[model samples]
Target: MDTNNFEETIKPFFWVAHKSSFSVCLNAGSYKPEIFETREDEGFEGNGYDWGSLARVFLDERKPHLAEYVRFDPEAGMFCAYSSNPESLKEFIVDFKKACEDDAVINDLFSRAELD
Candidate 1:
């Protein structure tokens, strides 16, 4: 993998951590988890920072092969995974989407990443 080139292609996203849940915005896009007030049941006691770390570990273990491209920014609650091979990236995204649907924590982070 071309580390320098891969780093150059990384896209940064923004997210907002709420008391329990969080929201993400992509490329100046609208904030997701928009109906925050109504999602009280989805809220957790932990903060976004903690969730970010959890997300990092989850993805690392869940898709060990993609470890090289997966990165997590706990401070911003942002996650990025990039690869020169579009097919590989697409495969990872598909697996990740399945994971998100199955795991709540991953779902939260994935939703915030705005990957879909």
Candidate 2:
């Protein structure tokens, strides 16, 4: 995942994920992940570049959607998972959080999600 132009590489993956409606960063971190409805917004107070929002540098290519599988870690990279039953956000988020803690469980959830 090493590259000279980080934005060029990461932006496309996120764009595809956004369009496909995949969730991102399903973890137990303090900041929870989100599933966005649109991408009509951009910029940080017009681009101040807040700390720890590294994804923006590349995603700022057009202001990335908030819906992509999301718990981002500058050091560890992105980990993603999904669920078909998004009708209940609270319940699924809880499931995602618990599943994300284990790689196998999250992958299993993603596999099951893909079948639906």
Tell me, by lDDT, which candidate is best.
1
- What Cα-based lDDT does every candidate model obtain? 0.42, 0.30
Deviating ranges (above 4 Å) for candidate 1: 1-55, 69-79, 104-116
lDDT of 1 by residue, 56-103 (tens): 555666777766654444333334444444444544545554454455
How much is the lDDT of residue 109 in candidate 1? 52
Clashing pairs in 2: 23-68, 23-69, 24-68, 24-69, 24-70, 25-69, 25-70, 25-71
TM-score between model 2 and native: 0.22
lDDT score for candidate 2 against the true structure: 0.30
lDDT score, candidate 2, position 24: 34
| Candidate 2 residue-wise lDDT, 1-116, digit = tens | 23354334332122113443434342222222221101113321211111123232323222234234233232223333332323222233343344445556433333222100
Model 2 ranges off by over 4 Å: 1-87, 111-116
Worst 10 contiguous positions by lDDT, candidate 1:
28-37
